[model samples]
Every structure is written in structure tokens, then in C-alpha cells.
Target: MYAAFRDTVSMREVFDSCSGVTDVVSWNTVLGGYVKCGDIGNARMMFEEMPQRNGVSWSAMVGAYAGSGELDVAREMLDEMPAVGRNIVTWNSMITGFARHGLLPLARKMFDEMPVRNLVSWNTMIRGYAVNGEMDGARKLFDVMPEKDVISWTCMISGYAQAGRYTETLELFREMQSESSARPNEVTMVSVLSACAHLTALEEGRWAHTYIDKHKMVLDNDFNLGAALVDMYAKCGKTDMAVKIFHSLDQKNVSAWNALITGLAVNGDVQDCIDVFEQMKRSGEKPNDVTFVGVLTACAHSGLVDEGRRCFQSMSSSNCGVQPEAKHYGCMVDMLGRAGLLEEAEELIRSMPMAPDVMILGALLGACRMHKRFDVAERVQSEIIGLNTRQAGCHVLISDVYAAAGKWGEALDARRVLQKCTIRKLPGSSSSMR
Candidate 1:
């Protein structure tokens, strides 16, 4: 009971009181309690003082050492263990340690040498490969696994989603549905919803939502899953459905709020996006970088110059304390440029703590074209050239700005420079369903 509660102090006191009556099990229990509490030194002392040890005792020490990242000592302990004490648990501890520390080769070596492997052993290996961005390695192992659990499927799906292979993520989910009995859990649905949002596969997203409801996966209870659903609907241009899901959630975390705000902003519902941000603040959920991005985006879309400036100022440490990142600055620049405040936009770029990226400059150049600000456009073109950016849009914008001002020679010069730079614009494409 003491061990279960992690009451190491009480367990140690009781063990010392009944020293003569204590068995190996008692000692192992105390050792495990210390290990669980992360007191490796005390655990080691407990191990050394043990009158007799068993497989559990040895495995505990090996696992503790491996977990603490002392792999060398863990190996030494494993080597010293009698054949009877060196069990699968002990071997797995080493593999888990190596895999967690990004030592995939060593983990595979240990895995290949294990005399016998369990489901956990396979899952750990696959998870290691997936997390390390080696999806091919993970997939190869996942395909041959004797049996797959929910965790096994979730790891592969999550890996594909994280790696931006959204189409494959959805494909794997479909395969899992038909081929595996393990029902998709909250985690599985989160990854699936993310894939659907990226691909704008509204039908698949709606199907996943239905599956969640059928399985009694309460959206109100699971904030992450709720947020994903909100995000999926919002991305697919179903703002009303997204709003419905967002309101249905009883527990509104920062993520859920971000999804709603960003979704509304993307859909061009500027007032609703701003209102949601205000509601988020009133609810005492601190706005994160993402939340502000959405708020600024809405402001940009509608030319809310004064509101955007105020929001940008609030991001300082004295206010909401979300230090404005490049993206925030980009939104501000875009907002100001759209309002025909080119000088103020350029000033903000210059005031940035870090070097301005190409996107920020591109916004100013585009603004220059709209306002016929040929002088500022020329200055921005020089900066773009200095950065040696390969973004074809910026060069094209420079030529357009010159052409708009009736400066034909300058426009021709801009095109000649673009040709000399050997930049090729990528063809745009769209995805559709039959």
C-alpha cells in the first residue's frame, strides 16, 4: 500500500522497524518505491544492502539506471546479473533508454539480440523510429508486427501527421479501420482530424466526428480532441459547425480557443474572430502566440489598423506578455500596408529585433504596388536583393510596382534581374473531390 501511494519515507521506516522479518519482496518493494520517486542514490543504497536479490530486484536497478540516462551503469548492472535475473524487462529497459536518447542504432542492436520479444518490445521500437522522423523504418516494423495495439496504430498515424504526410495519415486510418479490431481512441481521432483539416477532406472529417460520437468519446471532456474537431470544421470553411463544436466543449483550453479564433479569421469573419479573442481573455485563459496570430489576421483582413496596433502593443511583456514573433510582425505589416500606411509598415520592419524575413518584405512591396509608392518599392527591392531570397512573388511584385508607376525602363530592369537570378515560379494547383 505504501509503495502504491509512493510513500517511500513511510515504507522505509516500516522496513527498518521489521528488519528481521523483511524478505526479498519487501526489499524490492522499497527499492521500486525509491526508483519511482527518482531517488536513484537511495535506490542504489537499498540494492547494495539487500541480504538476497531476485530477478525483480535486479531488473528494478537496471531499469532505474537506464531511465536516469546512465546507460553505461545499466549495462554494467545487466552484465553482473545472473542469467536468472536477466529477463526481458531488463533488456527492454535498455532499448527504451537508447531509443529515448536518439540512439536508434544501439536500440535496434539491443532489440535484435533479445532472445524473446513481447508486444511492448515491438511497440517501443516502432515508436522510437517514428519519433526520430524515420517513418520508413517504423512502417517496415509496423507491417510485420505479430499483433498491433491502439498505441501502435496511434504512433504511426501521429508520426505521419507530424511529418506533414496528411494524405498518408488518412489512408492509414482507413486501413486501420478495416484491418484492425482496436477501435480508434481520442488520440487516433485527433491525428485523423488534423489530416482531414490539412487535406480539406470535409467528408472524412465528418465521418471521424461521427465515429467519435458513436464511440461515446465526449468532446466536452477531451479538450484536445474537441480542439481538433473545431479546427477541422473551421479549416473546411464550415464556421457555423466549428462554432457549434466550440460552444459544446465545457472545458475551453487555450488550444480550443486558438482553433476557433484562427478558423473564424481564415473564413473572413473578422468581428467574430475578435469577439472570440475578447471572450478568451475574459475567461482568464491566457492568450498564447497562436491566439494573437489569429486576432491579428482578422484585423489584417478587415483593415482594422487601430485595433491591430493596439493588439500588437498588448503582446509586450507589460501586457499579455506574448513577445511578438516574426509571424505577429508579419501580420502587423500586412495590416498596415493594406491600410496604405507604407512608411509605418516599413518602420515596424526596421524596428524588429531580428532580421526581417522575405514574407514581411513581400507584404510591403505588394502594398507599394497598390498605392503607387515607387520610391519605397525601389528601397524594398534593394533589401530583397540583399537577402538573396528566391521567392519569385517578391520579384514579380517589384516589376508590377514599377509598371504601375509608368516607369517602363525600371520595370524592364526588374524583369531582367529576375531572369538573371534564374528563379522559377512554382505552378499553383488545387485539390478537388468527384
Candidate 2:
């Protein structure tokens, strides 16, 4: 009972109070409790005090050492174990430890040297590769597995999705559906939906939603899946479906709220996006950086300068405490520039704590072209050139700004610079002397 609760102090008290000798099971249980609690010192002492140790005791100690990142000590313990007593569980522990610590080569070496293998062993290696962004290595091992499970499929699919290979993610999911007998779980659906969202594959995403319904995969229980579905629909220009799913969730987390809010912004339902953000705050979900991005995006879309300014200012330690990141500032600059508040936008850029990126500068330049503010455009051009950017679009915009203001020489100069930026000599070629 003491070991089950993992209350080592109480267990020790009961152990001392025992009038009779404790069995090996009792000792192993206490040892496991200490390991579970991460009290390695006490666990080691308990191991030494054990009159006789079993395979469980040794395996527990090895796992504890490996888990705590004491790989050398774990290896020593494993080697000390009698060959007959060593088990696949012990080998897996070592591999898992090495993989967790980013020691992939060592993990692969251990996996290859193992006298026997199991599903867990293969999964561990595959997961290690996937987690490290080595999807090619993971796929190689996955293709040859004697058997595949949901975990194996999820690991590969999610890996591709995370690595920004959305096309491959969907392709693999299709293969999983047709070739594998294993059913897709909530995790698999989440990745599938995420890829669908990125690719705007509304039909495919709808199928995933239908599959979820057919399987009775409760969205209320998994907010991540709920959020993914919302995102997929929103990106596909189906704000109505996204709204329905958002409202269907009995419990909405920050992620789910973010998806709905951002979706509304993308779909040009500016007012609805702002309303949902207000609703989100009233529901006591502290607005995060992403929430503000959606809000600011909505404001920018509809030229809500005052509202955008208010929302931008609220992203402070005193309010939502989300410091305005570069993107947030860029959105504000874009909004102000579009509204013909060129000076204010330039002021905001100057006030930024970090160096303004090319995108932020480009927004100001584009606005200068729109408003015929050649003076401001010239200054922005200097800043862009100062940054040594290779973006031809910014340079073209500057040339257009000059042309709009009837400064032909300056316009030609800008075009020449753009031409120079586009030209590059081949590695083995040069201009002929004559």
C-alpha cells in the first residue's frame, strides 16, 4: 500500500515498524517508489540494502539511472546484470535514454547490438529519429517493421507535418488509411487536420471531420483536435463551419479560441473576429500573443486604427502581458500606413526595441507608393538599403515611388540598383576582356 501511494516516508515508517522480515517484493516496491519520486540517492541505498535483488530491482535501477541522464552508470548496471537476467526491457531503457538525450548514433548502435528486438524497441528508435527531425531515417526503419501500430503511423505522420512537409503528411495518411489496418486516433486526426489546414484541402479536412464523427471521437475531450479542425475549416474559407465547431466544443481552450478568432480574421469577418476576442477575454482565457495577432489582423483589415492602437497598447505587462513582437508591430505599421498615417507608422518603427525587419520596412515603402509620400519613401529606401536586403519587391516599390513623384533620375537609379541585385556571375565564368 505504501509503495502504491509512493509515500516513501510513510512506507519507511511502516517498514521500520514491521516486526517481521520483508520479502523481496516489498523491497522492490519501496525501491520503485523512490525511483518514481526521482530520489536516486535513496533508491540506490535501498537497492544496496536489498538482501537479494531480482531482475525487477536491477531493471528499475537501470531505468532510474538512464532516465536521470546518468547513461554511463546505467550501462555499468546493465553490464553487471547476469546475462541470463538481462531482459529486453533493460535494453529498451538504455536506448530510450540515449535517444531522449539526443545521442541518436549511440542509440542506433545500442539498438543494432541488441540480441533481441520488440515493438517498443523499434518505436523508440523511430520516435527518436522523428523527434530529431530525421524523418528520412525514421521512414527507413518504419518501412521494414514487421508490424505497424497507431503509434508508428502517428509518429511518421506528425513528423512530416511538423517538418513543414504537408504534402507528404497527407500522402502518408492516405497510405495509412488504405494499407494499414490500425485505426487513426485523435492524434492522427489532429496531424491530418493540420496538414489539411495548411494545404487548404477542405474536402480532405471534411472527410477527417466526418471520420471523427463516425468514430465518435469526442472533441470536448481533446481540445487540440478541436483546434485543428477549427483551423482547417477557417483556412479553407469556411468560417461558418469553423464557428459551428468552435461553438460545439463544450470546453474551449486558448488554442481553440485562437483558431476561431484567427479564422474569422482571415475570412474578412472583422467584426465577428473582434467580438470573439472580447468573448474570449470575458470567458477568463487570458489573451496570448496569437490572440492579439488575430485581433490586430482584423483591425488592420477594416482600418480600425483606434481599436488597433488600443489593442496594441494592451499587449503589455500591465494588461495581457504579451510583449508586442515583431509581427504585432508589423501589423500595426501596415495598418497605420494603409490609413495614410505615414508619420505615425514611421514613429512606431523607430520606437520598436528590436531592429525592424525587411517586411516591416517594405510595408512602409508600399504605403509611401500609395500615398505619394516620396519624402518618406526616400528615407525608407535609405533604411532598406542600409539593411543590405536582396528583396527585389522593396526596390521596385522604391523605384515606383520615385517615378510617381516625377524624379526620373532617382527612379532610374533605383532600377539600376535592382538590376545589379538581380545579376550574379557564374562561379566559373567572367566577362570577356574584349
Candidate 3:
């Protein structure tokens, strides 16, 4: 009970003064209390002082070490635990710990050695593979599973979605539905809707939305699913429907608001985005860094330079309660550059707390192209090259800037550099309405 409340100090005091002699359960409880408080030293001390040790005691120590990222020690403890006493939970704990740390090979090896396997063991391995970008490995394991659950399917779908394999994500969603088992849940729907948003698969997105409605999946109750729906409709050129859904939500949170704001900004509904931002503020929803990203982006797109400046400045102000991150700074630089304020943009970049990234420099080059400022373009090009960044868009922008200024030799040189750079731009994706 004391452990549940997380009063480790008090729990310790009370345990030490208790009327009864200490038993293994009492010792384990105190160890757990220390672990909960993240006092690994005390937890270890208690573990060593315990009169007797059981699987629970050993598992607690292993988990404590694992939770603190001391995987080597956790493994040592695991090895020390009696082979007869190491249960599925203990093995799962170690596998989960290794997987969490991106030690997939070690995790897989342990997984192979486990005498018993359960759904969790299989799912953990699958998730670990998916997270480590070993989708082929995840697929291989997934195919051989004797029994599959919703989490297993969701993990694969989420993996594909995260890797930006949007088409495959939708295909898998359809496949899951066609299997007649493992019906898509709220989590699965969110992943599917995210893929639809990226692909702009309006028809498929609508079908998913229809599924949610037909299944009575409780959009009003599930903020994440509701937000994903708004995002999908907005990205699919159905901002009106997105707006309708947003207004209908009774329990909107910051994330839900951010989704709507970003969607509106991406759809080029600049005024609407700004208005919604203001509404968000008036509603007392604290705008986070993401919310400002959308606000600054909308301002940049619509050439609202003064508004962008104000928004950027507000990020540092106490009233706004958010700090400007790299993306936010990038948006601000882009806004200034687009308005033909190349000098101001460069000055802002120079004053940044951290080094300006290629995206920031590339925005300046884009501005140079519009205003035909070859000197500024040359400066930005040098900075971009110095970063050793192989962003193809940066090279392409430099070439365009030179070409627009009628510097054919420099343009050709830029193109040559682009050709020499090994990095390639990913192919752009688009989908049509059915």
C-alpha cells in the first residue's frame, strides 16, 4: 500500500520499526519501494541484506537495474538468479529491457533461448524488430506466430506507418479487416488514419472514418482517434469536415487542438489557422511548441511576417509558456526570407543559440532565388556546404538560385556538386480522390 502511494522514505521508516521480524516479502516490499523512488543504491543494499531471496526478490533487483539503464548489471543478476526459479516474467523483463535499449540482437538471442514463449514474448520481439527498422525480421517472426492478437497486427501496422510506408500501412489495415479476426481497434484506426493523411487517400480515409462511425468506436471518448480523423480529412482536402469534427469534440486536449491547427495550416487556410490559434488561446489551452510550429508555418505560408515575428517572440515570453525549437526557428527564418528580408533572416540565423541547420539555410537560399540576391545565395551555399549536409533540396535550391541570377557557370557547378553527392531525394508521394 505504501509502495503504491510512492512514499518510499516513509515506507522504509515504518518497515524498519515494524513489530514483526523481517521476512522475504517484507524485504522485497522495501526493495520495491526504493526502486520506485529510483534510489537504486538503497534498493541494492536492501537486496544484499535480505535473509532469503526468491524469484520475486531477484526479479525486483533485475527490474530495478534494468529500469535505470544498467543492462549489464541486470543481465548479471539474471544469470545469478537460480535457473529453476527464472520464470517467464523474469525472462520477459530482461527481453523487454534489452529491446527498450535497442539491443535487438541480444534481445533476439535471449528470446531464442527462452524455454517458454507467450504472446507477450512474441509481441515484444516483433515490436523490437519494428522499432530497430528491421521490418523484414518483424515480418518473418509475425508470419510464423501460431496465434495473433490485435496488438500483434497493430504493431506491424504502426511499424509500417512509422517508416513512412503509408501504402503498405493501408494494405495491412485492409488485410487485417479481411482476415475476419483481430478487428481493428482505436489504436489500429489511428495508425490507418495517419497513413491516409500522408497519402492523401481521401476515399480510403473516408472509408476508415465510416468504419469508426459504424463500429461506434466512441470518437468523443477517444481524443487520439478523433484528432487523427481531423488530421486525415484536413490533409485530404476536406478541411470543412475536419473543422466540423473538431467543433463537435466535447473533450478536446492540447494534442487535438494541435492536429486541427497543423491541418489547417497545411491546407493553406492561413486565416482559419490563425483564428483557431487565437481561439485556442482564449479557451485557455496552453499552446505547446507544436502549436506554435503550426502558427508560425501558417504565417510563413500566408506572408504574415509581422504575425510570425510576434508568434516567435511570444514563444520565449512567459505568457506563451513555450520555448522555440529548431523547427519553430526554421519557420521564422523562412517567413523572413520569403518577405525579401534576407539580411534580417541571416542575422536571426547568426543569433540563434545553436547552429542553423540546412533547412534554415535552404530557406534563405529560396528567398535569394525570389529576390535575385546572388551574394546572399553564395553565403548561404557556403554555410550549407560547410555543414557537410547532403540534403538534395539544398543543392537543387542553390542551382535554382544561380540559374535565376543568370550565373550559368555557377548553376552548372552546383548541379555537378548535386550529382557528386551520394544522397538521393526520396520520391514524393501523392494520391487521388476516388
Candidate 4:
């Protein structure tokens, strides 16, 4: 945009670079850019500063905050909207934001209270339920829709895909294909392909790939369908096919790298995950938290304690400018514990500026369980159970730890606590959450 403006005769024309693109195009781009940059603060400032706010501007801000995991901010913004009438897009934004944060009840409530709705609104709610693993709810809603469109069908299929309901997902895809009125677009194909990968249905994935190729989807295509195909192949365990598809792409983005890195990690190719991480760094593509998760998971699975720590320490570089959050800390504890450095793990947890949350302590406690350290296990049991008695597997482990030490009374007490409590484990459960 800047280059085009520079080449033009009218030097008076300003670019978004000049902070003059305050129209929907400019505001949307800037707001969306803030989201993509993970600077929700700046995004919110830009939003508040906009002189005229339209549905697009409002929707952009809502989506921006939601995308950056600021659902509360989104809800507050939604509440401030004019109540004379609600626009479907703005309502959908709130619904989607709630869904993104796993507040399915809130999303459903919004859906129920809406005066009017469109296909996107319905799709947003359905996808929300689907992503939250409430497939029954998704199906229930799906069964009652008075009308169905490609988006509605795609949302249903996506829910199944996310929930690992491949058979149902594929069946729905077949149904969609048979229906002449609904044509599956690239987004629909992405979901279907994702389902195939989840089920490891390589044969079925091949059929989908063939269809995409037959239709010349690679030429002037939707956003990175080829890369999605590569990810689908990698996940389906068709390594050669995935490589071929990946090599065929002339351009690749960080998302493409993420898919491959995470797929390799899931497949237990830890060395490959590390190699890909290095390759991505060499390619000038900075690693995000998702990238760190994949690499850290690989390290945990492969017992690369020192390597994991080294990689984690390197994250302090100003180039990436990424902070090591609770997830990163938890991964480190897991790695240290896996390598039998129980004392070191314990020390790291204790030294953290943010009080060690359940995740870090849980990792350490799990290691204690593996190593039969009754003392550490006993302390960890108290902390973890205090955080959330309803946490699955922890109560059992702590009870077993007591039982191992011949403390039958304590074991029984642990069992009773689990049986009696309906305690809710706090959400996010991170040191920073405090």
C-alpha cells in the first residue's frame, strides 16, 4: 500500500502507515493487526479512539479482544453497545467470543436471547458448543435448525472433527456432498480434512485430496488450502505425501509451520519437531506460544531435559520478545521431573516469582508419583487437592501415595475428599492468573 502510494502522483494521499486509514478498511486492518500482534491493549486504545464506530468497527474490536483471549473485555464492550436494537454481526461476535473462551453457557444464553439471527449466528453457537466438546448440544441444535446452509453444515462437521467423531464427521460430509444445494467450500474442506486427520483415515483423506486436485484448488485458491492439505496428510501418517505437498507450496506462513511442527510432535517425532523449530527460526519466522508448546511437548515426551531448558532459556532473546508464561514453566517442571531431577524441579517451582500454580505443582507431583517420593507426594497432594479436589487422577495418586507409605487412614481420607467434593478447579490455574 505504501509503495503504490509512493509511486502515485498524489503525494497528498496517506497510507495506513501514515495513521490516516480510519475507514472500516483502515480500522479493521489496524484492529486486526493488533490482535495478530497480540497487543490487545493497543487494539483497545485504537478502538476507543475511532470517531465513528460501525458494526464492522465494533465487530473488529470484539473479535480482536476475543482472539487475544480477552473475552471479559469483549463482553464489556458488547454491554456498552446501543440497546435500541442488536445487529446480528455484533451479537455473533459476542457469541463467538464467549465460545472462544469455552463459556458455552454464556454463548448459548446469548443465542437464546437474540431477537433475530442469521446463518453465521447459528454457526457461531454450534461451533462454540462443538469446540467446548458439547457435541450432544451441537447435534441437538443442529437437528432443530429451520434452515440449513453450507456454513451450518460446515459448523456441524467442524464440531465432529474437533470432538474426534470422524465417522460422524465423514458421514455428514457425505450428506453435504449429496445435497445439491450445499456446496462445500475451502473452509468446509479444511474441517473435513481435519476430521480425517483426527481419525487417521488416510484412505478417506486421499479421496478428499484427489477431489481438491481435480478441481484445481491449487490454482488461485482460498487461503492456503494446499498447506492445510499438507497438515492433513502429515496427521494421517502419510509422511511422504505430506512432504510432497509441503514442498509443492511456493509460499508458507507460520500457521503452516505450526501444523507440521505439531503434527510431528504428536507422531512422536521429537527430533523432527526440534529440527523444524530450528528451521523455522532460520527462516526468520518467530516462534509463538503454540510453537513453544509443540517443542516443549516433544522435549517432555523424549526426556530431553537439558535441551528443553536450553531452548526455554533462549526464549528470553529480545528478537522474539515472547515471555515464558505458566505453560512454559509447567513444561520445564515436567521435563526436569521426567529426567529424575526431583530436587531441581522442586527448587525451580519454589523459586518462581509467581507462586507455583496447580499445573507446575501437578507436574512435580506426577514426577513424585513416578519416583515413589512419598514426602513430596504428600505435600503436593495437599496443594493440588486444595486447588481443586475434583481434579481427575490427582486424588487417586495422592491416596495411592499414602497407601504406599502404609498410611491407610490418610488414604481413606483422600478418597473421602474426592467422593464428597463438587469443587470446581479454577480456570487457567496459572501463576499469572493470580
Root-mean-square deviation per candidate = 3.8, 5.3, 3.6, 8.8
TM-score, every prediction = 0.88, 0.86, 0.91, 0.65
- The lDDT per prediction is 0.90, 0.90, 0.87, 0.75
Residue-wise lDDT of candidate 4 within 1-434, one digit each (tens)? 42333322232234333755556566555555555556677767767777667766676677676666678877787787766534787788788878888988888998999989888888888889887889899989988887888878988887787777878999999988886388777777877788887778888889898888776666124566766787788888776677677667777677777777877877788898899889989988888887888888889889988789878888878756678888888888888887888888887877676777766876776777677777887777767866764564566667766777788898898778766885333465521211
Error of 1 at 24 (Å): 3.0
Rank by TM-score, highest first.
3, 1, 2, 4
lDDT of 3 by residue, 1-434 (tens): 54654677788787777767467888888888888788999899989988888999898888888767799999999999998778888888888888888999999999999999999999989998888778889989999998899999999999999988899899888888888498888888999999999999999999999999999887756539899999999989899999999998888888789989999999999999999999998998889999999999999989999999988888877767787777888998889988999999999999888899877887788888889998998988889899988778888778888888999999999988877887565678211100
Candidate 3 segments exceeding 4 Å error: 1-5, 220-223, 412-434
Candidate 4: C-alpha lDDT:
0.75
Error of 4 at 162 (Å): 4.8
- Please report, as a residue range, the 10-residue window in candidate 1 with the lowest summed lDDT: 425-434
Candidate that beats the other on lDDT, 2 or 4, i.e. the better one: 2
Candidate 1: tens digits of C-alpha lDDT, residues 192-220: 99999999999999999999988889775
**Residue 105's lDDT in candidate 4:** 89
Clashing pairs in 4: none
